[model samples]
Target: MSINVFLFSKSFAQQHTFEVKNGSFVYDGKPIQIHSGEMHYSRVPHEYWRQRLKMIKAMGMNTVTTYVFWNFQETAPGVWNFSGDRDIAKFIKTAQDVGLFVILRPGPYVCAEWEFGGYPWWLQKVPGMHVRTLNQPFLDSCKTYIQHLAAQIKNLQITHGGPIIMVQAENEFGSYVAQRKDIPLEQHKKYALAIKNELVHNGFDVPFFTADATYLFKGGSVEGALPCGNGEDNVDTLKKRVNEFHNGEGPYMVSEFYPGWLDHWGEKFVKVGAKGVVNQTEKYLKNGVSFSYYMIFGGTNFGFTSGANDGDSPIQPDLTSYDYDAPISEAGWATPKFDSLRSLMKKYVTYQIPDVPDAVLVIAINEIKLNKTVDLFNGIVKNIQPVVSDTPKTFEDLNQGFGYVLYRKKFDNAINGTLDLKGLRDYALVYVNGKKVGELNRQVKKFTINIDIPANATLDILVENMGRINYGPNIEKNLKGIISPVMINGKIITGNWNMYKLPFDQVPDLSKQKSSYVAGNPVIYQGAFKLKKVGDTFLDMSNWGKGIVFINGHNLGRYWKVGPQQTLYLPGCWLKKGKNTIQIFEQQNDVKNETISSVTKPVLDKLNLPKE
Candidate 1:
């Protein structure tokens, strides 16, 4: 019996061994090429996690890549959640169950176009905090996070018979350093090394790597870690770039090979054709290179978690749908691209790939009438108490992260002129005496508007925190709402102002609220429909103006009439078989019909691109 136990232990110890050696990835003493696809467990419904993994594996991918979002895990300082959708270990184990390896990218700074680049919003509130830096405060917070995260995933490493063979240290840090001229390169390198060290200290025993573009290697690459490239299409350039930095070594890999592009509000939808993607992927496979599709199955951003980008523009917030036009649709259905890629992968893979999972059930519900309507000021605003402040406070100042903030002030005297919202972060709706007169959008660089006021008129400005900038130097100061005071006719409109905190963390109860819809004012429209059956469906919002949709208390995400994205992808897992309730917060009350319909397919490319 003792001899048998010794043999079993030896076999287990020799089961898995993955390492980067001699310019190639050596797995179990043999060279192997890794075909991986990126998918974030946070973006997809937890109920559909297994299905997504199965679909990716069916696409002939032997490995699955995912980013561990710090902000999603640690909601507040010293507070962490690792259950349900935030469960990284379960996600890894599920990948193993589907016969795929795991490559973990646990970014204290994962700029997957995620909110605040996945840094907890409260991180900005930390005293003397300089994010992505070796600043003690930020590093201390990072250490605590790594410690807690290790407790959840440390034992799941490949060294311990887990599927996680490779772990990423910091995500695309060089790109950030290159954009920020204020910080020194050496300092950034030290900061990157510090994070990698913290991961090592916390029991991450797998091979570590740093990913960046070719030019960013100087700033992003750390000693004792392999340097990989991102977005480099040409296999030659990819190999040359890695060899240049790695003492002429050859196990070249592209950590983020984009199959499709990201979408932002007010812009046309970004699409990548199957021919080009197939061509590039063929080159990678033929050349015996390792690569991972940035998103093989792009999922939904769901709720206020969508982020924005500021690439020499004011601010372009990402849409609710992170579909990325990938091979897999947002509703977990396989697309034509998936078939083409799977066919291409079959030629290279030795083992037989499993057939794609059967498509989930999809049902279309006809228009459901909105039976209840309540104005923003008359009803919804009254639900929360306002913070009395002599000066205007930004969202961060009030300790609020996401959603809207209502700024109110009463004037005893009459006034009329151009009102400028100094420091309007993203978007705002201006109202005079419960009437929405005009709006201010940060995306188009519109911050001032002409307004007429009457004596004793109460003014309210509803500012929506569209999203925090996910990339570049601008990420540091992404303070939403009005950061400064209001100005009318070049004069400061100052006094005791009331700032209402509407984080919308919890959906408000409108069951008892009476209907009071005022045209042109933000209204909460509620309705219920009997659903004897429920499945994946899309809520059509093309006829409605900009606002958010909440179904059965789940915040589906924001919608706008601007264009590109007109429907919110509602997962079937969130719906019930009986009655389902949907509440919409329409900003301009521009709905041609006060009702919505659920369709079988998503309407992502319907473009009403804003006329600047």
Candidate 2:
């Protein structure tokens, strides 16, 4: 490879020009194929970023592709966080240091099975805001996100001696536009152009590409940008489709070659075997078709960052563990899939692949007894002030985005009738007079339960915003909590009600709260386990019910009795060599023994198979 030296800042830098010409990626005037793997910085801990990048390179990947989650960086309107795990610039820089080029996909709307499809939940509050379109309010916000994001990485572009080569426009937009019968093709193209223009306006000076299925190229691709196919491994089909839509053929790339699949709660874990991945990858390598494994190393969702999918099936919320069953496990350990792919890459790539890094140590600890408990109905959490209203309000109405919300109403007169929960976005645990009643789940399509209400009875309905719809048209209407009205029998229960916003932004200090376990109510259980040495481990949640877990104050994400994902990936880096604390906000399931064990391996495939 020829070196291009240029004077950068106060020092001479090795700046190389990257371009797509004559069907190939030409770096410094030499044609080369991109061997890329996708991994998101927002998904993995920042402490393990460098090691993960190194693993990607070791697997014979020369390029690292990532989606810059708009929601991850900007949690609220005008609020941006690029430091720590939200640091995309550092991630790209680290990839370059590990001898890998970068393909940046900064989606103001990236449906990576991420929360709200990588969109800030607050966007729903903007009047007349329609996402993935030319809606002015939405576009205005997109521009702001782009400007702030560009400020962090514009200097890191390949032209500026950085690793970023190609920047992706709106992700899989064709899928969204193709289904809309009311919208014209021309209007869709204009919408795409607007996003592409925003990228250019913010100084993202690089070759831009739009990724979609073959049929979506026309609707998803911008005029000046390259159109890349996703989830298509057949080289001939890929070429034909590109030529048919793009009017020019040659350099073909599969933006998302899935080695594994995403998992949703209450469903069987999706697994793409290593043999299948190897076969498809070998074909791509032999045909000189560039590709990026959708997830080379699927990490933990680590909080309420997981999204949901609602296609032909019922609304399926994604599990907290984004293990993806890929080459690397969620705990950052190598697997047979990784080994097989590494060997295959060594056979095809002319360049020398680096040696695989040493696997991170994983330790298993004995059962940790949860001795202290705090009731949610009590005063464990003192931050959330109740919003009093006549009717139940949604999470958005209360200025809250994620987490659970409690709706309480006291009836003065006794009534025997069916209690109907109207417009419950996701899941809810029903309680009357501080006693557990029946439950309502949006996933199971349960909306009403028969209840015998006594005089002076307090009805408490705690609803959880499982996750927003990350895909399809329904995302526009995703509002958590009771969106409409609660009814008894045939009449609306209209009166005074208190709605508490429990966003759980951080695990509250519950040490001062009473330490007694309350049955059938949402409670915070606390425990401690001492370790001589620290390493990666999985916390088994089979003994407990649905809730989020926090270790040493770091939110490890949600876990439910709903099988498929029974263990949560606990990183060793987050633990110390002494007493470590664990707190679980379990909402249901009366605990016989408040105990959980740290296991070495994850039990992700075990599904709660339905009975006839």
Candidate 3:
């Protein structure tokens, strides 16, 4: 790094004021240009934050923007966490130490493709709770949360001699819901205004901003804060929208300039090529537009927290790897895009950008073998005390946020016809009398299947909460299990039932099972391998089916045979120098032998998009 960058530091005592004036941000009475990158604090490991921040600086990015995930912070209502990877305060300080300014988006609803749009799962339980709206119950809760969250980093603002210069209201309010005659879009503008007021009233005194796509600025931006656009290619068009929305007090910027798009499970991963992205960056730079790359370094989803996309299209569940085919890979390795863009940035940036750091090393190891198995049929020992109900309850109704829930019932009479799960939250497997009959998935709109109910046969529907919609309407209405009672032959059955919640919070005890298992039943594969040295690796998922993997008890996230994302990133921080345990729970599998191996690279660019 250049000595000039540090010359401005060494002093956090004297506070300075920052303002948005005449199409630009001015600091200390001088026009300060911001070339920022979006990096989520919750997504990356706390230990590697400095490395990623340093990389952002090396890429010639002058600022770093991040969203504070309400869901991640308040895991349950009123219960809070800000330590370790959830520490946004520490993330900001690290950015300042690395000479990068900060733009904080503390969204009560951040549509970052995060689960429930960053809302806590408990919100679904609130009666008459309408999220991202004007409902008093929701807003009152948001207000309290705002006050609490602001108290943590209010002093980090530029006025307090810290790097934070901007904060955002509810994200992308304009494109949040498609226009409907039944529901007015003006309601969103009102909601945006409410969000701005909430931030200001709760001590977020920094300049607040709202971001959306180019044409949606009017509905997204409130009168008090600056309005920013998302896409590239048309600066003049965006400037016009800002002029029309913010009373010509233009401090034009692109808050979410998408260098790459997010990926959903089963679909081919998306990647914006190096040559074009560099060109696009140059266009914005030449026009003197301040912008932040939407996802500069996309990481992992970690647990069963990957959100879904639901609206016009069929449901799209996000894959475990949050590696959005960005400049930095999921494993923190700089890609060709990083190199090319850094080279182009050198020609425009006034400050000396540091040289690109060496790519993080990845160590691949041989396949580890497992001889013992635990089937899910017997894994029922870990399930919660079964709830009996005439009507099946949702995951939230059962006081659960994630994982699978099973509904079992037996019919008194034999029937052969279509079995309808009026509202299946996501994926489910149908079983009758200990035999797999069929399957249904919300992703494909498959909710009914032809089946036979032998006399008094027990019917079981094991449903997985794929993930809640994080970017659109109907977010609150996505109940995990069956929303209503099973309908056979157009009649709702009122019968005795068992509802078992499988949170997968703890691994099921495998030693007590004394019965034989079905060939395609859920298999818990356990293996152990000695590690000579700890480093990063991508566990090959080609040999396995859909399910989650845990190394040393750390949930690495989900994986499927679906192309584009072929490996699960295994961070070395979770590894040890000696014997390490590998545990995997396959939902349904054919692999007789349980084995695993690691690779040095990620499968980010493969296009396996299905044909229409």
Candidate 4:
């Protein structure tokens, strides 16, 4: 059958009448009920998207909702990528294929525990920019993104053949506006209205909605729209909130019913039990309310996509693993929550829910040992590079992300009092002659330290890009790398910085030299292993420092001295049976060069290394 016909047939088969009455949702022109679950395409791999969809369907859910992240699509402004896991078109199509309706939340601002709340970093660079306001540049960009997204899925609408029945505007605008305390209410409402009109003009034909806290919706300031409350766990409270604002007959949906919690660096992993979810779901369903679990399948925040939250204390950016302890695990495995929710759902729906898909096999490979060691710095100084100026530079000027940057300056005078960093925004590791000395961190704000600089000795100061400040009021001015001037004693040292951008993508050329000497910023450490018979094996990187590992030139993510993630899962597809080349770029020069072995278990140990 043709794609359109197939989509039409599938959508028609799962079609159920839904309407708004007096303000409540009506089914077949009558007040009908809903039970939904949430998931994101960017989190789940394309190959496993279908499996997760089936699992959600089995959980007795009639609808599946997802947030269409703008930054994920427009990785860089104007450039769009919709294939693979990012294919929202295919994701919606697959939802229809598996007998589930979809609700698309195309947020130019999706604060879904995502990096920058799904707003692209490029947007921050706009001149005279004030995000989420009536700023012309910001609004214009939002309009373009909405229009581009609409063009991709407009034809596939439920009114056409797709399962996307509703589209949400800005998420929790009232909370941010009110929380900003400094900003006036009138200014906040003006920004909200501008976003609503932008959506309308961008060909968003479906019903428009906004999710807010219970108290915010009751204020009666928002224009004509459907009201939905987030985090309303109590059935009575949710029903009361709906009745108060949405009228007695409106479709009451829990837009963001929190199913699982998130985690940050240096914290214990958080998890919620299956019983609690089932009980809450049952309560909501029995009370005649429709709900959507915020994240039924919380996927990985791969790369630098993780964001942060602000509450009582100041928290930095989020960890890479978004494993929200939801119904579906980050690796796409079905959990006890899935089974409990599924059993409860079967009691309410009449569809034939299929069995859960098989889980991916994660086997532990054997551990190997490193029998060789190499000294990184064993050369005398010759032809010393001169310093140009004594001015300090921020990370923006250097164009670097996470990791470390070194600042070196040569001086003829010997100073021993105290080395002062004019503006040390974050963390720094002090090293003399490639030897460990001491460290300074921003948490304590100690940027000055006493250091003895030997005469004719080249001074080296290494600074680590701990992490970007992801959320809250202080995020606007977050600049990573070395954010300022370097000084020795009380005098400013002038010279070339020889700035190094320690991004993981930088692969060094290891073919130029013998076992003699290599002087460069990113020194490539290479070792060859002759696999007797390689089928599939995990490379144990516990012996080495934090850095990306490449086997035959295949990127394994960033491995640090942090706990829970020491060994990277190397697929058998990337490994060959014989002689394999392994390369590692250590961000810190202090890392001991050790041989890596194959491990059958995941390494989860904390090391006494400097935190980045």
Candidate 5:
């Protein structure tokens, strides 16, 4: 096997040094300028890294900036994955290979519209864990991650012949204030210094900088480095801000010039006009200011990595499609944004931009009706034990993220009365004696129903974690499963509730069923669809309530009954020519009556199709 080291070396790092002289960026002790753009390698596949870098280079960009999501690296604490698309080192090397210098932002908390601000879920398990603060536990973990990451790329630094020139200390820290305008200067400085010190101690010699909104700087202080903002809409404003901040001593820089925006679950897709981006880029270049577009290419949120945001409105969780209306689409196809930027970039840079790569070929397969079915409740009861509770427990107390939990309790009192669920986060489907009783949805925050029950009968209440709060200021407060207390007839139920965590990662063992097929808890529904050929088709999830869907074992991600996403786009890569097995683990045991359908277009469309 051959190993290449020159791919990591940067031209500026080989012999050139960047300095600030007379308020101007001096490279190799001479006035220097830069044109940069931002993109994430994890968002794009490994095969497309070089092409995207070349695209940026073609856009006349001399520098390519990227954020190293800690969650993507150390998925679990102390566990690191650098292979495949998570290869940050390889990404940097590829950038250098394309004649582009690199800027690295390794954030333990990068709010790049990522889940948990790039912090891994396991971090929340730590005792008394507080993120992005002076918390010792948080700081200790941050230090460990920084040390490990620095070791990987520190040697590749410009001072060490590596492509990385500048390292950002943190990402937009002032956006969370009460007014969305004040920076926690003291806390920000302390944390930045802590990270800077840790990196320096770990042998990272590159200059450090911070990226925030322009007005945020007034609340904080940047002692010995560059401070760039995000609101560089036009060249004149960008120049004025840079001149005011740097006192005309250095080139103006927009750390995050928004090129496009992201979409929430219920919102329509967003697209930023190409003319505006081109005009802005031209203005910045002509004014001699360096800029980095927030996201040149947006990729898939694959798996459970998607996050939600909270503002003044309800929480908005991001959809699986991370097509942020970027230059590069979610499927890695370049749109008009890409070509417009490419043409604009060629005017200033000397590097040759490569042609866009071809899109993945799509193959279509015929749809077939699947009639094979497995009875879910055909089993003998071994131990039908039930506890007593006046009221049920909410999802919060269960400590689960998303999914269903069954609460069974024996009630001896004869009641032909109404049953009231105090805190059903969103929705619930009631069942009595293996029969459908009634349904409730929390959208209106009401889960009341009338049912006649025999005296001392076992009453079972199953609750679903109808999609956790995906966005808004309430995001951090999102807890899966049942959230609050359950009440019956204005009385709270208090008893020992059997809690089941239904996260996809904890696949329950199916071998314990006494019958050839066990139907209820942790049931895996399988159906085979015969297709003459396989091609790209959208799986219409409108029939299915809420559950993760898998095709032939490949996880397509979590699907919800809530719109405006009723269909999931299935790429042909995971499909087979003959028989394809569709498996669903429904949270509601009684939802066996619901049938999922596959359609060619988005299920939410007004086109009426034949229903099976």
Candidate 6:
């Protein structure tokens, strides 16, 4: 590899020629560093794209990097959505308009603490399917997705007079674990190379690279491509790791330098503080290295699309707010971290940054009265149709995803003993004859729950998918809603079971219902609030138990009493000016006379992190 390391002179004609040579990025025969920040367009509302970009630029970033969530784009099999938050082209162009370049990481598998590791839930429908390796089904799906995605962004490349200067072939491929134990690491390499081919075949002539943490470069790095590391170390450290593993003769890059870590439901909100972030920022910028801050602006996960983390322990669901404790808050407001970083970056990088934009609008809503309620059983729609099976099946077997499945059976004789759910996927709300009994939670790694079944009584188990394992070897086991049958007293209860698929896209009309039946059972609470002026807010879940919040038919996200996140962010963009409806489906808790409220501040219940 040859290098042309020349200093970029502003007085001279601004050369836009970008290439990798001699361990440095050369622009118009001059060395250039990419001070980039990662922020997903899918997470933020389309209305705030430009404002966030401006915020990123004012923080001394020269470029914006983002992951294209395949699941969010291709919601259903064969059906694609590129409009709204899933619109990638508009986002890239908006970044460009804000005077920043773009780095696109269009992963068929992006393990950014996202649901199903970015794989569409529909992939679970394919029989004998495998993922994240050289599997035919996954490869075919990836190819079709890439082809469709490339068509939308091919002309938008910087080479084609667009803002996207770099492209990542596959995200963290070297860190991949095969779907099957029999598969070899070499198969992973073939899978990555195939994706590289797909990218180049679709006319992406820009520099293509792969990103991995701690310099794991085996399956990810390919011939003629760059290997990048993701961490908080200085320039020399990131460069040394990538160079020793791949090539010392190429430009060094930190693809995902972490400023803050992701949070699980029961874990404390992850924060790196302003001092820690500024200390690292000063070192990397002054040392002539390129880096991208992972999630400089973490947005809301919104809906059941939020995933869980089961890396090597008990299952932990991710909170609704992707706030990340980043410099830019989830509400798009700047924190002290923003102030410190901006002051530090101006001290080093010799570039002009514009003034910081004003913070987003926020408002406090009045306490909402949940006047009406509908029992979950009363609200069951046509899709909850029952399927009688001798042996219980998983959600995929029933062609369902992202919801709860009810399994119930009736016994003639009285049995008083503990019930063993051999293969309960995650969490199951237990009920006896429509009465709440107990719960079996897989988060604590508990599979069995104590129960006393009476004579001629019905036993029902409602299993929910608390997001799919977003990272680690457990990903292949991402089946939800009871993958195996339940056993009690060492006997397989051989009886017909009714399965209700609760894929509640939207809440049904509460007025159509007679009245609230039971409290402990799953119920939907309905309320209305009149907004004189729309503004950002957080729907407080402190008053209720575990459930999701839907405002004006839009699924904001989930919340639980055992939460570090007790509120769901209600972005002003999602709110209308008039009366707005708020609905919540509490799985186990009863909300009778209690009412929910909306606050301006988010409650990252730090006190509850270590407990339940």
The best candidate by lDDT is 1
Error of 6 at 88 (Å): 1.2
Tens digits of per-residue lDDT for model 3, 142-169: 9878887888888888877788989998
Error of 4 at 58 (Å): 2.6
Task: Assess every candidate by TM-score.
Answer: 0.96, 0.96, 0.94, 0.82, 0.79, 0.94
Per-prediction backbone clash count: 2, 1, 1, 25, 36, 4
Candidate 1 all-Cα RMSD: 3.6
Per-residue C-alpha lDDT of model 1 across residues 466-574, encoded as one tens digit per residue? 9898888888888888987789998888888999988877776887787797788888888989888888899888888898989999999899988799888989898
Pick by TM-score: 5 or 6, better one: 6
- The parts of candidate 4 lying over 4 Å away from their true place are 1-22, 26-32, 218-222, 247-249, 310-314, 368-390, 399-404, 416-428, 440-450, 456-470, 484-496, 506-545, 549-556, 564-585, 588-612
lDDT tens per residue, model 2, 11-56: 4365678887877778878877888888889888898998888898
Name the regions of candidate 6 deviating beyond 4 angstroms.
1-15, 177-182, 232-234, 378-383, 591-593, 609-612
lDDT of 3 at 164: 91
| Model 4 lDDT per residue over 1-612, tens place | 001112234435665443456555654455556567888888755766777787777666667889888988986668998887688899988888887778888877877877667777656566887777667888889888888888888866766646777778777776676667677778778777777777778666667677877777743125656778788787666667766765454567788887787765444556678888888888877776788887887766654555666434344434455657788766666778877888887676555666777765554434333332222333111222323334656655654444455666654666677877747655566666555566665544467888887776656666665444444555465565555556666666666555444444444444533333332222446777766554434557666554556677765545555434455555454566677677765544444554567665444333343465
- Candidate models: Cα lDDT each: 0.86, 0.85, 0.79, 0.64, 0.63, 0.79
Query: What local lDDT score does residue 192 receive in model 1, on the 0 to 100 scale?
Result: 92
The 10-residue segment with the lowest total lDDT in model 1: 1-10
**Model 2 weakest 10-residue run by lDDT:** 1-10
Cα misplacement distance, residue 283 of candidate 3 (Å)? 1.3
Predicted structure 6: lDDT: 0.79
Q: Could you tell me which 10 consecutive residues in candidate 6 have the lowest summed lDDT?
A: 1-10
lDDT, candidate 5, 1-612, per-residue tens: 011223334343346565556766655565656667788887665766776676666555677898888878886657898888888899988887877778888866677777766776566667886666657898899888888787778876777766788888766654544332233557656766676677778887777776767666543325555777776576666556555666555556788887888766555556689999889888876777777887776666655666666643344566666667777655555678888888887675544555555565544334434333333333212322332234454444443434466666555665556677755655566655555577665543456888766776655566655444432234445554345665556655566554433445443233454423333432456567776676556676666555566677656665665555566667655677787777666544434533456655444322222243
- Comparing candidate 1 with candidate 6, which one achieves the higher lDDT? 1
Q: What is the lDDT of residue 354 in candidate 6?
A: 79
Global fold similarity of model 6 (TM-score)? 0.94
